[model samples]
Target: MTFNHIDFYDIPHVSSALETKTNSRINNCSSSVSKFILLGFSCTRDIQILLISIFSGTYISTLIGNLCIICAVRCDLRLQTPMYILLANFSFLEMCYINATVPNILANLFSEKKTISFSGCFLQFYFFFSMGTTETFFLSVMAFDRYLAICRPLHYATIMTVQRCFRMGACCWVCGFLCFLLPVYLISQLPFCCHNTIDHFLCDPGPLIKLSCSPAPTTEMICALYNSVLIFSTFLFVTSSYTLVIRAVLRVPSAEGRKKAFSTCGSHLAVVSLFYGSIMVVYVSPTAGNPAGMQKIVTLFYSVLTPLVNPLIYSLRNKEMKEVLRKLFRTVR
Candidate 1:
C-alpha cells in the first residue's frame, strides 16, 4: 500500500516477496509497469451512468463557455487590448486543462475496466499540471496588467504593448511546461511495483509518489519545493498587484472613478479567489494527506466548475462583453 522510506539507489535489490509481487503484476518488473488502473469513482451502474451524463454536460458547457470568450475576443475589434488578449489565452488554457483529464474520466466511467496506459497517465499528468502552472503565471500577469492600468494609468499603454503582451503570455507557457519536467521525470523513473491503482481520478503526483517501490524523500521534497515556489511566488505577485490597484482606486477623488476602477478588476478578483483558494488547499502541502473524496471534489471545483463559470463571470459583469456577445449572436441568427 505504501513504500518504506529508503535510499533511492538502494531500492534495486528488493525483497524476494516484493519482486514476486511486482512480477505478478507485470511480466517484466525490471522494465516497470505498462499500465495503471485509475480507480476514479466506484458506484453502482446507475450512478455511473448518471455521472457520465453530468460530466458530459459539464465538459461541453465548459468548452463552449471558454470558446465563446476566445471567439468574442478575436471577432470584436473593440475587445483587442492587453487584458482581453490575455483573457482569451487563459480561456484556451482552461480548455486544455479540462481536456487533459476529463475525456479519460468519461471513458473510464463508461467502460467496465478503468485502465490507463503508463504513458497515457503520465501524459495526462504532464499537460494537466503544465496547464495549471501556466494558469498561475497567467493570473499573475493579468494582475500586473491591472496594476499598470490602475496604478500607472499614463504608462499602461506604453508598457503593455500588444507585442509585449504576446511575449509575456508565451513566457508563461514556456516556463510552465519546463518547470514540471524534473518532477514528472523523477516520479516516472521510480519503479512502480505491485500496486498500480491510483485512488484519484487522474495520475496526480501524490499517489504516483506513494506508489513508488521505495520511498523517495528527495523526490517528495523536490515536488513540494516546486509546488511551494510556484504557488507562493505567483500568489504573492497577484496579491501585491491587487494591493497596489486597491490603493490607487482609493486615492481617486470621485466616486465614479473608484467604481469604474473596481469594475475593471472585480471579475478577475473573483476568478483569482476561486482558483487560488481551492488550489492552495490541495497543492500547497503534500497531497498524500488529503482524503481521496476531498481531492476529487476540490479538483473538480477548480478544473471543471471554474471553467464552466468563467465566461459567465466575465461576460455578465462586463457590459461591453455582453453587448459584443449579443451582437455576435444576432449576426449568427
Candidate 2:
C-alpha cells in the first residue's frame, strides 16, 4: 500500500547570493538515512545520568527478580507442580521482554549518538513482539490452570497433569512466536525513506506505524483487530474462569476454605488486573489529542515496568514461590 509522502526536512530556499555561497561550501547530501534517532527520556546531561541510573537499577532488578523466580521454582520440590512451572515460564519470558528494550535504552541514554541502525531497530521489535506474545499466552494458560484448581478441585490433578501443562506451555510459546511473525515481516517490506526518528524509547508498533511513508491503514486495522481479539478473548476466558472459581468457592461448606481459595488466586488476579489494565489504557483509549509524554509513560508501564513486577508479584505472594525461595536460599548457604 502506498501512502502520502511526509517530508522530514523542510529546507527553506535562500536568496541567490546565499545559495551560491552555500552551494560552494557543501558536498552532495544524498546518503539515504540508514539509522533512526531514538530521543529517549532526557535531553539534559544530568537528567540523562539520572535516567541511566534509574533504568540500570530497574534492569538489574528485573534480571534478579526473574532469576529468583526461576531458581525458586527449580529448587523447591513442592513447586514442581504445574502452576509454578507456568510461573517459571513467565519469569523467563519477562526477562527476555525487558532485556529486549531496557539495555539498549540505557545504552542510548549514555552514548553520544542516541541512534539505532534500521536492522537493529527491527531486531529489537522482533524480540519484543515474541516475548510479549508469549507472555499473553502464558497468562491465559495460567488462568485456565486456576480455573481447574478452583472450579473443579477434585479433577484438578487429573486434568492439569504435568504432561498437559507442558503441552499448554509449549503451545503458548509456539503460538505467540508464530502470531507476531506476520506483522514483523510486513514491517520489513516497507521502505523507510529518510525520516527515522522514533518518538518513543523503543521500536513500538504505534510509533513505527506513524513513521511509515507507505499507507498502513490495512496493516493498522489488522493489527488493531488482532490485538483486540487476543486481549478480549484471553480476558473473557480469564473472566469466565474466575467466575466459576468464585462460584465454587462460594459453595464451600467452610469460610476458611473460601478464604484459602481466594488467597491462592489473589496474586494471579492482581497480575491480570495490572497487565490488562495498562494495556487497555494505552491501546483502547482515544489518542487524538494525547500528548507524547503521556504516551511514553504508558508505554514504559507495559514495556518496562510490567515485566519487572510479574516475578515479584508471583514470588512474594504465592506460598509455593516463597517455599521455593526459602529452599533455594538454604541450598546456596
Candidate 3:
C-alpha cells in the first residue's frame, strides 16, 4: 500500500531534530499512513552489518535447536509419553513464536526503508501475540502434566492418554489464536494520525495505541485486561501445579526419589521464569511506560533469547533427552 514518506531521520525523538518538524509533518499529512517505519536500531553501516550477522546466527541456531527437540521426541519411542509430546509441541510453538518476528526483523535490517505494510504489521501483531499466548497455555499444560505425574502418579497414565494429550495441545493452539482477535481488531480500527513511525521493533499494542489520533481508553483497558487475564491465569495455574508437585516430592521418604522429581521439574521452571519474567514487565501495565530502549531489550529477552536457550535448557538438563538426541545424531551420521 502507498504511504506518505517521511524521512525517519526527520522524526523529532528519533534524531536531534526539533518537535516543530514533527508537528509540521503530522500537520502536512492529514490522512492515515498505510505503512509504518519500524525504527528497530538506527546505527552506522558497520554496526548494522554486525547486528545482521549476530541476529542471523542467533535465528539459525534457535531454529536448529528447537527442531532438534521436536525430532528427538518424535523419533525416540522411549520419549513418546505425554510429557515428551507436550515438550515437542512446545518446541514447535517456540519456533513459530520466534519466526513470526525474526525473519521480518532481519529483512528490515537489510532494507533501507525499514517499512512494514499495514497488513504485514498487523499480521505480525496477530501471530506474535497469538503464539505468545499459546506459549502460556502450553507452559501451564506442561506444569499440570508434571503435577499429575508427581502428585497423582497412579492416575497420570490414565488421565494423560495419548488421545487426551493431542486434544489438550489442539485446544491450546485454538484458544491462543482466538484470544487476541478482538483486541487486535479494536486497535486496528482506531484512527491513526500522521505519525507512522513505531518506536519499537515489532508492532506492539502499546505503541500502536500511542499513535492513535484519538484516545481509546476502552481499547486500552481491553488490551490490558486480555494480557492480565492470560498471563496471570496461566501463571497461577503453573505455580499452583508446581506447588502441589513440590509438596508431594517433599513427602517422599527416599532422598533419591525427591532428587529425581526435582531434577525433572527444574528445566521447566527455568524456561517459565525466562518467559514470564520478561513479559510481565511489558504487558502487565496498560501504558507500558518503559522507555523504548528498555522495551526493545525486554522484548528481545523473551522473543529471541528465550527461544534460543530453551533447547539447551530442556536437552542439557534432562538425561533421557540428551541420550536420545545423541543416539539420533549417531543414526543421522
Of the pair 1 and 3, which is ahead by lDDT? 3
From the highest lDDT down, the ranking of the candidates is: 3, 1, 2
TM-score of 3: 0.90
Regions more than 4 Å wrong, model 1:
1-32, 286-288
Reference-based lDDT, residue 296, model 3: 93
TM-score of each: 0.90, 0.87, 0.90
For model 2, residues 1-333, the per-residue Cα lDDT tens digits are 999885544445545667777554432221365678887776788888888898999999999999998887777677789998898888888888888989898888878778998789888888887887787788889989988887877999999999999999999989988888888887766656557788778887777777776678787777777778877888888888888888888899999988889888888888788888877776666542256677788778878888888877877777767776877788889
Q: Candidate 1 overall Cα lDDT vs. reference?
A: 0.89
- Tens-digit lDDT track for model 1 on 180-204? 9998899998888778889988999
Q: What are the lDDT figures for the candidates, one per model?
A: 0.89, 0.80, 0.92
Count: clashes, candidate 3: 0
Clashing residue pairs, backbone N/CA/C < 3 A, model 3: none
Give the candidates in order of TM-score, highest first: 1, 3, 2
Q: List the residue pairs that clash in candidate 2.
A: 3-215
TM-score for predicted model 1 compared with the true structure: 0.90
